[model samples]
Target: MINWFDIRDYGAVGDGTCIDSPAINRAIQAAAAAGGGAVCVPAGIWLCFSIRLASHVRLHLDAGAIIRAAVPGAMGAYDLPEPNPHNMYQDFGHSHWHNSLIWGEGLTDIAITGPGMIDGHGLTSKGPGAKWAKRKGYFPESMAGMSAAELAAEDPEEAAMQGQGNKAVALKNCTQVTLSDFTLAKGGHFAVLATGVDHLTISRLRIDTDRDGLDLDCVRHCVVSHCRINTPNDDAIVLKSSLALGQVRPTAHVRIHDCHVSGFDPGSMLDGTFRRTQDKAPDQDGMTGRIKLGTESNGGFHDIEITSCTFERSRGLALETVDGGMLTDIRVSDITMREITTAALFIYAGARMRAPEGTPPGGIRGVRIERVRATDVDPRFASIIAGQVGTPVRDVVLSDIDITYRGGLAALNVPVPEKPDAYPEPSMFGPLPAWGLFIRHAAGLRVQGATLSTTQADGRPALWLDDVEAVHFEQVDLNNAAATPPLVCRDVRGLTGEMVP
Candidate 1:
């Protein structure tokens, strides 16, 4: 045996059934103080509170080793020191406390690697008195009883909602990290969230959670590959930038490849909740599955490449720039999907971020989706919808796509007027319906070698395009058993189709 044991030197023991966070953290801190080394959690189930990792330390769990959270209330035990300014809300938006199951900050060369399991006990910790439950409402209960300074001194979760506190693993402001070959189960929020980290690689991991499986926010130069993520609440893998009031720089240069994601809950998935405003209109809820980009993206993304992936039983592929950020130089190819409930692919550019009273609108540019196939999709949605809300989606391209719809195609942009005698103003908008292929409010779009087929009892068009510019459709085939048009185009300029009309 390699004797990777650190207990004899700076020991901490937990049997996976008892609270051992203090001992383990003490040992880790001791090792870090004496110049960094590995903290070994040998094969056993150790019940623990959240343990903070130090710089240059490795938390190695051997096979059969399981470290589970002790109880929900134990999270506030090692609350991080409050930031200066003594004002409770000074660091409110950027603070990292009260949100992570396993968290670390300002570390280097840190890892939690093993062929073991880290069960978050998410279902056990979901409701009130649970971490996530406290952050559900707009104002936290803890904030009511404390002054601003006292709230600052307390953990960030004391002031924040329970919804923001349910992440399983969070690594903030760290660099040179690698997480591989592990299984993370039942995350309260995101299974793994890495923010403001550089040179990170996450691979060969299996994450099964109710919330987002892997959420990479405000990070740069990272690679994720060879992973399997199954969640029921949100996107399997998500990349986002800071969407709060302050402007954190965008996360850039991200690459994701060779992953399998499915079985996600499409109804409750959402992004960009941090940007919600009281003045803005209410959001329309829909099913989201597979890959998604911001409803919270304020930090703009660039140089992203996704290749060789599979999506199963997802709502659809959503690339939304609603939060006033720019997404540029993005490429997706060689993807396969099954049982998609909504559009196969959707790109909206008219996503505007709620600026601080007086800022310019944000938009998305330079997007591409190629060589993708979707099977068994609901016909009410389209194979693709690429356009902006009011602005135009620019420089978009779709090539070599084969899609089969189980329902008829519909439109996504039909405006719904509010009833006059309703509640003063419109409380809801009608569904933005779509067809097999719906492209609206876009510029410089090209669709080549795209194929669509419908198996629904009702006959409807296989494709629909509205308010598009400079669109080219080459070698397109729409196979349907209905009398309706196979393709519908409205207000499009320079549209060329060989077999699409």
Candidate 2:
């Protein structure tokens, strides 16, 4: 156990009202310059500017220690590091150069551990700017002194920028990192963003953010366990890969277990994919799903597992390959979800039809979902949407699952017209074959030991299969309080259900 105070003879300095960001940073730098060691922040309210971490350093905040972000503009100016090639689409905004509440880059074996809290002061930092941007229909014209338009107009590929948004912690190109036993709150963007790193572990952490709780991009072999991530914007925990089209570097072998995620609203979230239709330019937008893949899934994802997790009041689940990328060998088991408003699972392969599109059409094969239960799902649009327009979903199995729907399930076979004039738009856009399990344009799907129930008047069939092939259902139960047929099959063949058609 390396003691930070022993190595550098450092101690706590709290004036009670003012921040000690620079002092703590200087001490940490000095200690790191000598060799690797820990930098401890003793219990108290330490108002700080941004803190830049060094390699081989451990920033331990003692219990009850609250490290708050300094008032905006308190920290002096600093140069923005060069753009990380891995995070091109992630807009850092204007303040990409200055310090963060806690920031590090190219680090290894660093950690922030303790039973304490780190606040980003985002209410003060982001409220005015975000409000003004909303009114102006863009970011402000100027922030602090720099021209907001100039900053926004500057080419991300060429601009030398620093920090933007009051992030609590940002780790870039780091390895062997651990952040545990901390309460992170009120971040400007993401509470914790680990990019291009490996062997990372974030556990026993409570993250309540206005944005994403944990955003992992291009990372490998990571584990996020026993954490409570509550966010109003994007996914509570999101794992992503390359953004460039046709890039296939796969964020593989990741595991998320024993966590509670809540409050994911789909309407307000962005998936972080920017596509221009005429110019084929890329911009930033939030990707959908509480746990998602590809708006930027250029690199494929494989060997990922999510188990023993609980989701509350979520919009959706397991959004795989929205823009275009392959997702395989993924397992979701022993998961319980409640109060879901949207489809429980969405496997989309549509390409964002932009000029100079970069993504290739992708598919999901060898995916398994077992022992999953959901309740209070809006039946109107709650069902799995799998397979692409051309490349149908294949080799998927769902077993031992139970879903209680408050509304009804929507079919996944609505034809997406490339252009509005491609087909005569029909009236009475009827509810898409609302059912318990709806499968369309999929092949080789095996569903076993599942149950679905709903309480609605004029309830439709519990199971609806349309335009599908090679389906096998064994011991599946589709029960509703209302009197309705249990199964509906349209334009399908080779389908078998124990209860019959």
Candidate 3:
């Protein structure tokens, strides 16, 4: 007793030219009226405006089908994300979901399963332009430069939707969701943005986008697997916790595995053809495609695991919790990285209080990264784990890791900034104190069966420590020919380490 509602029956002309959102939405309504069923989009280039999903409905796309997003204008064909006071801390594109081409809110048992393509051909990641920013006359004189509560008091209807053409698929407060086997091209700000969702599964996706491939925010109990993503302009897979939900909702219990991410040409990865159309250095070009947790950590993270992932021509692995959340019990293993422009691994805990005022800095603890192999890493920076002044990252373990880098001579007395409140980035610290690994303001660090080698002669030491405690290295080898001492320690307490020079 399956109820199947086809879009073509609802007068959807899939000829790539007409606006078919009304007909597709009609089909979805029909299916929803029949007590939850499948709404099918057949094989064609179906142009649409916005497709909102209902509960217990699955939107399935046939092969060779493409849902193209329509362009917005003064007539308001597209909606803007709902405005909030916390949005000023984050970008406008990261604030809302209802304005997207496909979106769901407060839904249950919904899925967008596909073997087709979703092309955001006419979406803009940049927020409101100068003209739209000037269109705030409806916002009330008393509401000007006021708090979120104050602004909401003046305008209870929330008639402000500033930015347009942002995300491709955005979901909020959803559960038991699944997104699978879809190809996305030129996905605007983010290809997929999921927030406050539980029991979610995203797999077998081929995405070649202009911006971030997938952004999981405030999600719980999720699994992302078997995806090939190439974004020459932004991160491939990113996890974030922003204050968009009006409170702290940590992203936890997540597992991501068996994914291939690269900074290759946009369409090359999905076509099974490797092409290097990007001419800029992978790191220098601002095309960041890596698996990262937190540049937005107001809510914090917990119990996350990423394994068996491969990265090529992209940035390295990163873990950061800078806002007022506690990051704990994270493990990453079996990672193979090549041509990394940044450090092989970067873990940072800073004091960027992007949350409400008086929110304390976050913490990082119980992190384990093992069985990693990185080759052709840029030597300007080293693998780094740095905590803030008052709080140090605790109980970190690195085992069976091999990194071959392009290390050269480190200049004398390179000053690294302890930017506790600044933005957290690997390159933001400038040239690292060590050529291989730099440990700062950390405790209980253990490195076992590790090897750090250089492709060229380097005058810097292989390891350096500052404000660190209880560091023990076992069977660690520093394969450097020109360095005088393999290890350098300053203000470090309880260091029992000897490198196999």
Candidate 4:
């Protein structure tokens, strides 16, 4: 039985000026009333406020149709979800969902699918009502600001009505969700924010957002595949175990494959114009794209597999567990990265315990990375895999890896800081001690059939081992200049092959 309800029938004026959220919600209510069905939005520019999603209802946008977010002045027309006081524990964006264009909570069997687009016309990555300003190239003009306390003081309804939309789609405590075949432009904060969601399938989506493309928080059994994401302001695809739900919930059993993540110019990926606004890229450094595991990790990631992906003009693949969680059993294979501004691989286990006090530091183990080919890697910072002092990352295996770094004469005296309690970032460790690979404070490390080369003359060694034990490098090829030694060892125990045991 096919139960279908069109938005136009329920008085939705798709001419782009009418407030269509009521009609859309009414159609959704009618569809839900009839059990389960599709609430279809036909071809038109439907300017809407918040569109609340219900279970067993699929919001499908047809071709040439656009669900545009209403501007700040009209924000009061949207529906606000219940306020969560615990949102203070996380960042400003992760704290609320009711301020989004489309949001759902405690729902099941819901979907948003089609070839059409959901344009966050009135969303921003920073400040108040930021969407009102245009992104000239990289940095948008600044807007009025609010402190954390002031932001919390405003009425939730007023904030959504007068401020910028924070997200395009937000879902929490949901199951059996499907999001596919849609284009999301200028998605604020996150294009899709799924927390505590299970059995989710996200595929074939094109997202050129200002912030994160998709954030999976405390989600399990999710597959994100075949997506093209150009997020110059933040990460492309990220998995997190935040303390948003006021509990410890780990993100596990997630597979990300066949996706192309880039730090290209905004609005280019969607318009078939792949422009490069190199000067206007966000962050102190020009690194905004790439897949990341954490900055907000209370519970850790497990059973995660990332394969068959491409990264360009972005940061490297990062795996971090800093907040008293366990990260284990991860695999990454068959990846290619070009113009990498950072390391090809970064694995850090720190003591940034964001959880309740008295929690111990976390650990990362049983990880394997193979068949990775990276080019134009930054010569100053090598691919780093390190744990805290006395607490080593365990059983990491790298095989068949090839990296070509950009070499320039380096003084090679940058001290890596052990900011165990500060934020965990690839650049936080400062300029690396090696030119290719740097391994420190780890155990049971294995490297086989790996090659490292440089484009120009580099003064640093190809490999540096510090405080590492049970290490074995077999058939490793270090193509450094004749004046530079292939391996440099300091306080390394149980090492073999290139290094004297």
Q: What's the C-alpha lDDT at position 3 in model 3? A: 82
Give the alpha-carbon lDDT of every model: 0.63, 0.62, 0.83, 0.82
The parts of candidate 1 lying over 4 Å away from their true place are 1-11, 73-99, 122-165, 264-289, 384-386, 408-434
lDDT of 2 at 76: 40
Lowest lDDT sum, 10 consecutive residues, model 3, at 129-138
Off by over 4 Å in 4: 74-77, 127-163, 498-501
Q: Which sections of candidate 3 miss by over 4 Å?
A: 74-76, 128-163, 279-286, 410-412
- Whichever of 1 and 3 has more TM-score, that candidate is 3
Q: Write the per-residue lDDT of candidate 3 for residues 317-406, one digit (tens) a residue.
A: 989997788889999999999988778899999876666667878899999999999999888779999998769999999999999998
Count of residue pairs whose backbone atoms collide, per candidate: 27, 23, 0, 2
Q: Of models 3 and 4, which has the larger lDDT?
A: 3
Q: What's the TM-score of each model vs. the native?
A: 0.80, 0.79, 0.91, 0.91
- What is the Cα-based TM-score of model 3? 0.91
Clash total of candidate 4: 2
Tens-place lDDT digits, model 2, residues 1-501: 584642124443665466577778877887688687877777788877678888888888888788876554545432243443323332442213233568787889888897888877632223111111112212211122445464444333332223334467877778999999988877656677776778999999977666667877778889999997766444678877655212346778899999987664321212322221221001121222256654445566888888898877665565455335577888889989887645666554444311124546666788888998888875654366455456777888888988888754333445422211110011112244555666766888898888877765435666676678889888877666666777777778798767533
Per-residue lDDT over 92-197 for candidate 4, one digit per residue giving the tens place of the 0 to 100 score? 5666677788999999999999899999977656522212122111121111144546444322333443346678999999999999999999887788899999
Stronger candidate by lDDT (2 vs 3):
3
Each prediction's RMSD to truth: 8.5, 8.8, 6.7, 5.5
For model 2, what is the alpha-carbon lDDT of residue 74? 49
Model 2 compared with the native: what TM-score? 0.79
